[model samples]
Target: MNLQSILSQHIIKAVSESYAATLENIEFQATRKDFEGDITVVVFSMLRTVKGNPVQIGETIGEYLVANVAEVSKYNVVKGFLNLVLSDAYYLDFFTSIQNFNSYGKVPATTEAIMVEYASPNTNKPLHLGHVRNVLLGYSVAEILKAAGKKVYKTQIINDRGIHICKSMLAWKRYGNEETPQTSGLKGDKLVGNYYVKFDKEYKKEINTLVENGFTEKDAKAKAPILLEAQKMLQKWEAGDPDVVALWKKMNGWVYEGFDATYENIGVDFDKNYYESDTYLLGKDFIQSGLEKGVFEKDADGSVWCDLTDEGLDRKIVLRSDGTAVYMTQDIGTAIQRVKDFPDINGMIYTVGNEQDYHFKVLFLILKKLGFSWAENLYHLSYGMVDLPSGKMKSREGTVVDADDLISDMAATAKEISEELGKIDDFSAEEKTQLYKTIGLGALKYYILKVDPKKRILFNPEESVDFQGNTGPFIQYTYARIQSILRKAASASGYTESVEIRNLTLEPKEKELLKILQQFPDVIQLAAGNYSPALVANYTYDLVKEFNSFYQNVPIFGAENPAEISFRISLCDAVGSVINTAFSLLGIQVPDKM
Candidate 1:
C-alpha cells in the first residue's frame, strides 16, 4: 500500500547481495524528471571506503536489478544512480488497486493522537494576510498528517486578554458611542479593528503632548491612564466584575463571528480552542509546581524565572513580580493541560512563526527538564513571515490587508476572469458558484503553499498568481477535464466494461502518467514524514502537469483494442482520483466544470 516500502524492497533485493548481506534501507528516492525514471535507488551510502569506485558499484546494481527484479523492466546506471524502469504490469496492478477502492485516496487511520495549535490571534483586530498563511499552512499540515494516519486534534489559544485587546475596547468606548457592526455595515472584527487603529492615533497624539514636557516614551506610556485602565480591566474581568466581563465577552464574540467566516472561507477549523483569560491562573499553578521541584527560582523582584543562561538564552520570567503569567508561562500550562486531557497523544505540533523558534526550543527543553518525557515529541512547526512585495505589512500604519476583504476581492477577480475566458458561459447557477469558489480558494492556497515554508514569500497583489497556468485553478480545471473524458468513456462502454491492464500498451504518455500515479503514496508519506505540506503541493502540481501532457499527446478510447480503451480509461480515472485526494489535502476543491 505504501509505494516507497515496496520500491525499497525491490531495490534491496537487487543490491543487498553485493553489499555482503549487511545492507539496510536501500534508499530509493523519486526522481524529478521523467528521463531518470520514477524511483532512483542510491548506492553510495552503502559503500564506505570501498575498493571499487561508485560508478562500478552502480553498474553492478543496475545489472542486478534488470536481471533479478521482475518489476523493474529496465535499468540505467548513471553516476551512482540506479534508475529503474517498472514493468507495465506493475503499473497495471497499481491502477487496479487504487481504482477498486473508492476510499483508496482517503487518509489512512492511525492510533497516534496529535494536537496542532495555530492561528493564535488577538481579539483586537480583523485577521490579516499573515494569519491566512498561518491558517492554510496549519490546515494543510493537519490534512497531510491525517493522511499518513494520525489522530489529529487541531487547536488554538486565543490571546484574548491583555493591553492589546483593551486598546480596541477603549477606543470603541471613547469614539463609538453605541455604534454596532449592524448599524455601521462593517464586519464585527473589521469594526473592532477600526477602533484598534484609532487607539494608536490617539495614543501617539497624547504621547507627543507628554514628550513636549520632557517625558520619555516609556514614561509617557506609563502616565497614560488608558494603559492603566486596560490593565485594570483585565484584572476586573478576572475577579468576576460582571460589567467588565460582559464588555469583554461582547467584543470577543464580535471578533469570533468574523473569524468564523474567514476560517470557513479558507477551510481551516479547530477541534478545540483555549482562551488566555481562562488559562492565566493555570500558568501560576504550574510556576509553583516548577518552584517546588527547583526547576525555577524566585528573583529579588519576586518574579519567577527559568535560568536558561547556560543554553545561551536569556533568563525568562515565567511570572511577573505581581504574580501574573507571561506568554511563555501560559503556553507551558496549556501544554500540560492538553497532555493530561489526552494522555494517549503521540505529539503536539505548534504551527507558529519562525520568530518564536527560540521560544519553542526553550519551552520544549524546560518541559523535559521538568520531567515530561512526551516533551521529546512536542515540535514547533515554524514558518517564515509572509511579507508584502513592498515590505512587511504594518498594522499601526493601517496598511494591513484584511483577510475577508482580500478573499472577497480574489473571488470577484476570479469571477471576472471566468467570464472573460468564457468559462462561465454554459454553467447553471450552482455550477457557476462552485467554479467561482474553487478558483478563488485554489488560487489562494496554491500561491501560499507553492514555496518551501521556511523561506519567506514576497506576495504582490498586482502580480498575483494566475489561474490559466501553473496555478491551483489550472489543476482544478484539468481534473474536471479528466472526469469529463472518463464520463464519456464510461457511457460509451455501457458502464460495465472493466479491462485487464496487464497488457496496457506502454506509450510514452501512458508510461509517464502511470509512473507519476505510482508515486502518489510516497508523496503523501514524504509530506507527512517531513511535516511539510509543500511536498503535496509540489506533487499535485507535477501530477496535473503530467496529466495535461498525456492528454495532449495520447488519445484515450480511440484505439482498436477494447483492452487498450478500457485500460486507458481506468488509468485516467486513477489519475483523477489522485488529483482529487491531493486537492483535498491543500483544502482546495475540484469544480466539475470550469
Candidate 2:
C-alpha cells in the first residue's frame, strides 16, 4: 500500500490501455534532486513491452498516472525518466498515519526463528578489539533481524578445553605463590592471561638453554621442559585426572565470571553457551554414521574425512586416526545440537572472522551433503580483522587492546571531548559520567559499524568521539537538539497533539524529511535481508543529516500559523523517535540531552 506499489499498479493499467501492451513490472528510483518530483519511473525498462520512444512512453504513462492516481498531482518527463510530483496531501497523510514513530518501522515477530552465533572466545585470554567488533556486529544483526520480524537467539561457544588452556594452568601452578584473582586485585581472565604469557617466556628460556647445549632449535623447542609439562597436563586433563579437572573447573569458573563482566560492560549477552569440553567429542557418533552412509570416508590409518574436492574444497578431517574429534567435528556437532535445542530455528548465522571463511563454507557444504534441510539456510557473516592505529595485536604476547580497557578509554575520550566542548556544564557529576559513557560507547559502536563488514578497520578512539561529521556524537547531538525543541514546544500552548492539517502549504525541507522517513520500514527489510548493520548505520546518519538541514532552514516555533507550528513540531518529534529506534537497532543509545 506504499506509493511505489500504488504507482506500479496504475502504470501497468496505463500501459495496457494506451499502448495495448502488457507490462510485467515497474522500475522506480529516487527522483533526482534537480528534478521537481517525488519519485521517478524508468521508461527505458518499459520499452520491451511498450513500443515507442522512451520519452514518449514516459509521457504517456505520466499522463495516465496524473489522470488516474489521486496522489499524482503533476508529472514531468526528462529523457526517459517519468518523474511524478505527488500531492502535499499524500505526504501529510503519511505523517498523520504514523501514530507512534518510536515503534513505527518495526514489524511484529514472525514464526521464523534464527540463531546468531558471536563472541565465541577462547578461555586463554581476555576479549580484545577483534572480539569487540564481532560482538557488535553480531548483536546489531540480531537486533535488525528482530526488527524485521524474525525470532532471534544469540549464542556463543566457549573454547574452554584445549592445549592453550593447559598452558595457562601449568604456568599459574608453577610460577604463582598461591595468587588468586581476589588476592591479586586483577580480573580472573587477566590473571590467567598473565600466566599464559609467563609460560611462553619460561618455555623460550628452556628452549634457549637446550640450544646452547648443542641441541637443534626445533629439537630444543620440542624438548622444552615447560612445553612438555603443559602437554602432559593436557593428557592428564583428557584422562579426567581428578586434580587437573578440579583446577580447570576452578580457573575456568573465575574466567567465566571475568567474561560475564566484560560482556555486561559491552552491552551484549548470549541466550545459550556451548562449552568445548562438553561438545568436543559429540561429533564422533555422527562421523561413524557418515562413514556408513558414504557421506564420509575412513582412511587406512582410521581417520575420518569428508571429500569436498568435487565441491572445490580439499578433503576435511572429521576425526583423527586416534578417533579424537577435530575442531570441524565439534563445530558440526554444535550446529546440530543447536537445532535440537531450539527446534523452531530454521536458519543460523555464524559471525566469525573472514579467516575462517573456507571453514564455514566446508562446514555448510558437508551439512547439506548430509541431507539436513536447515543446512541450506546457513550463513557465514565473515568480517575482516579490526586493527588499531598502532598495529595488529598478538594475544600470546599480551599486547592486544583489552575490551575492558578499550571501553574505559572510550569513556575517557568522551569525557575529554565533552569537557573541551563544555556542552554539559550544567550536568550533575553522576549525569556527566553517564553521558560520557553513552557518547563514548555510541561513538565506538558507530564508527566501527558504519563501514562494511568485509573491510578492515583501523580504529581510532579519539576520532570516533568527535562531535561533528558522521560520528555517533554528532548524531546524538542532533537527537538531543530535537528533544530540546520538543521540550520547548511542550511548554508552549496549542502544540500538544499533531492533528491533520488542511488548506496548508508544505515546505520543501518538510517534504524531503517525509520522503526519508517513509523509507524506514523498507530500509529495515533491506538491512535484514542482507544481514548488514552498515546499511542501518548509514541510513541513520543520512536521516540525522536531513533533520539537521530541516532544523536550520525551517521555522518551528516562530511560524505565524498555529497549524504549521504544530505540524513542524510533530515532524521534529517523529524524526527524534526514529533516531532513537534506529540507534537501538545498532545497540547505540541516543541521549535526550548532551
Candidate 3:
C-alpha cells in the first residue's frame, strides 16, 4: 500500500486511542515547501470526531504516529497541520520495489470495457483544426482508459450521406474536364473539397442572377439551379439510382483514401468505422416499437415525436410524416448497434464539440427512458472549439486550417527552430527529418491537450514549439537529457550495474523526486475517472520540472561514491521511462536526441 493509505490507518487509530473518538477518514496534502515534512495531515478536519484544539490534536496524533509507525521517523505541528517526516529507508524501499519503470503506472486489463467515439467527420471536406482536437482528445482518452485497466475500443461514425456530399459530387461532375486526384496532383479529399467550394460559389452566382431579375432573395436561393440539381442528385442517390450510386462510391472512395493519409499522419486509428449510409435507417424499426410502447407519440401529420417536456426538453422528432428517419433516430439506432457489436462494453464516451451538448443530453435521456442498462454509463465528452490566433474557420469558403497542411507546417516550424538552435548539427539528413517530425507533432499534441477540454483554445504553432516553460519541447529535452546521462553512466567503469542502497543517506532533492514519482499511479487513476487528459499532461510537466531541478543541483557521475552514482542513474532512468509512457498516453512521441 501507498504511504497515504498506511498513514490514514495509523492516524485513525491514533485519534481513536487518544481522544476516545472514532475518525472515519484522514485528510492529507503535500507538505509545504517552507515546512520540513514529507506529507501533511490536516488536523482541522479531525475536530468533528476529536474534541480538542486543532494544534493540540495535531500534536497528539503526531506523537502517536512517530512512536508507533516505522515509516514516520519524526513530526512537527504547524498551526493545525501535522507534518510527518518519513524515514529515508521508506523512499529507498520504494525505489527498489519498482521492478520496471517503463510499465510502472499501468494496471493490468480488467474484464470491463469501454468504447470511445471520436473523429466522426463528414465526407464533404478535409479534416481541419477542430477535428485535430477531437481526434487527439478521443485517442488519448482511449489510451488512458486502457492504462487504467479498462478494455477500450476506439471508433468513429463517418457522416457519408446527405445533400452536403451531393454538393461536392455535383460540382465535380459539372466543373471539371475529367480531372482526378492522380491527374491534378491533389489529395482526394482536397480535390473533392475544392469542388464543394465550387458548388457554393456557382450556387451563389445563380441566386444573384435570379435576384437581379426581380426575385426575392429567399426565393432566389430556393430556386437556384445548382442547389436544385444537388437536391435532385440526393433524391436519386436515395432511390438507389445505379449511376448516382456508382458516382457516390467513386467520389467517396477518393475522400476515404485522403482521410486515411491524414489519420496516419496524425498517428490515430479507429478499431471500427460506422458509415451513415449503412446506419441511417436502422432506428426506423425502433421508432415503431417506441410508439407502441408509449415511449413516443404520433403527431397529426403522422410524424413520430418523443415528448421530453417533462424532462425539461422540448419534443424531439424521431421520424418524419413521410416515415423518413431523422438524425436523432439514426443516433439512437447507432448507439444500440454499438452495444450489440461489443457485448462486453458497459459504457461509451462521445468526443464531440460542446455545440452538440444538448443533443447528447437528449439522446442519453431517451435511451435511459427506453430502459437500456448501459444508458446510465453514457458520457458526452463535450469540448470547446479550437480557434487559431488569426480567427475562426469556415469550411464552405475553404478557409479552414487543413489538418494535412497544419501538420506539415508544424514540422516545418520545428525544422526552422531546430536549425536556429543548431542542436542536431551532427545528425544525418534522414535522422534530422524524422526527429523534426517527432518534435513537431509532440509540440502540437501537447499544447492542445494540456488545457482542460471544456476551455476554448487559441492555438499558436510557433508558441507551442518553444523549448522552455511548460512546452512539449522542454519536457522532451529533459527526457533526452536523462537518456544522455544514462548512456554516460553505462559506459563509466564501476557504475554500469545497479547498487544496493539500503543504508544510503537521502538528499533533499532526491526525496522530493521520490515524492513526485510516488503519485504517478494515483494520477493515472484520477485522470481516467475524470475523463481528462489535462490532468495527465500537467502531472507530467510537474515531473519533468522536478527532474530538471534534481539534475542541476545533484551530480550523478561525480557523486562521492559509486553507490550514489548508481542510485542517481537509476533515478534518471526511472524519470526517462515515465516521460516516455506519459507522452505516449497523450499521443505524443519523445526523442532520445533533440
Using TM-score as the yardstick, the better of models 1 and 2 is 2
Q: For model 1, give the RMSD to the true fold.
A: 2.9
Question: 1-594 in candidate 3: lDDT tens per residue?
Answer: 777898898888887888889988889999999998999999988888788999999888899989989999999998999999999999999989889999999999999999999879999889999999999999999999999999999999999999999999999899977788999999999998999999999999999999999999999999999999999999999999999999899889999999999999999999999999999998888887888889999999999999999988999998999999999999999999999999999989999999999999999998888889999999999999987677787898766888998888888888998999898899999999998888888888888899999999887644544546898888899998998998887777768555789899999999989888888998899999998999999999999999999999998888999899889999999999988988989999988888
- Kindly give the stretch of ten consecutive residues in candidate 2 with the minimal lDDT sum: 459-468
| TM-score, predicted candidate 3 vs. hidden true structure | 0.98
TM-score of each: 0.92, 0.97, 0.98
Report every candidate's CA lDDT. 0.80, 0.90, 0.91
- The number of the candidate with the highest TM-score is 3
Candidate 1 global lDDT: 0.80
Per-residue accuracy of model 2 over 1-594 as CA lDDT, tens digit each = 778899999999888988899998899999989998999999999888789999988888899999999999999999999999999999888888898888999999999999999878989888898999999999999999999999999999899999899999999898888789999998999898898899999999999999999999999999998899999999999999999999999889889989999998888888999898999888777887888889999899999899989977899999999988888998889889999999999989999999999999999998888889999999999999987677888887766888899888889988988899898899999999999889888988898888899899887644544556998989999999999999999898878584658556888988999999999998999999998999988999999999999999888898778898998998899999999999999999989898
lDDT of 1 by residue, 231-267 (tens): 7876776688898777778988988998898898877
Residue 306's lDDT within candidate 3 is 97
**Model 1 CA lDDT for position 188:** 87
Please identify which of the two predictions, 1 or 2, would achieve the higher lDDT against the true structure. 2
Q: Can you give the lDDT of residue 66 in candidate 2? A: 93
